[model samples]
Target: MLNVALFDKTAKEWREENKDLKGNMRDYASLNELLVLANMESFNAILIEKGLEQKERMIELRKLARNQMLSLEKLNKGNLKQLEDKKK
Candidate 1:
């Protein structure tokens, strides 16, 4: 099972660690969210396709990447929530 609390803490730490990120990585939260969505879609794509051995290996790679993206997104969600809470 995935740990939401851990993700949140990780996000907060990421924010602190990259407070001054610029250019493409500036919108950390938004970027992470996009990554999460893309990862999920790709993961679904892998399972939806009934292909050969090489294709299966490629799909597995995609799933691995998706998992990583989701973890980052969870962290981003936690960080954003913490910021919102602080503003309250």
Candidate 2:
């Protein structure tokens, strides 16, 4: 699961560790890299905190992504079932 809390915590740690840095560009870039890596590693489900300005939009996107995932899962299952039936 892609927990926002965990990301937040990790970002904070990175910020703290890089407090002497002059700009926030590096911090944000590092966070983006980490997120990309996590996604590539098969992380799913994002948990965000409440009161976010774009909460509704984020929720909608999440739902859409989840539905797509479900659809893909169903498709794979159907293909597997067909393969098994053919073998039998």
lDDT of each: 0.53, 0.49
Lowest summed-lDDT stretch of 10 residues in model 2? 1-10
Candidate 1, residue 70: how far the Cα is off, in Å: 1.3
Query: Model 1, 1-88: lDDT tens per residue?
Result: 0112113334445666677865332244465545554554565456556553654645564556557776877887999999999999
Please estimate how well model 2 matches the true structure, expressed as its whole-model Cα lDDT.
Answer: 0.49
Instruction: Look at candidate 2 and give me any clashing residue pairs.
Output: none
Question: How much does candidate 1 score in TM-score?
Answer: 0.37
Question: For residues 1-88, could you state the per-residue lDDT of candidate 2 as single tens digits?
Answer: 1223223345456667688886543345544344443552342233333333445534544554455556666777999999999999
Clashes of each: 0, 0
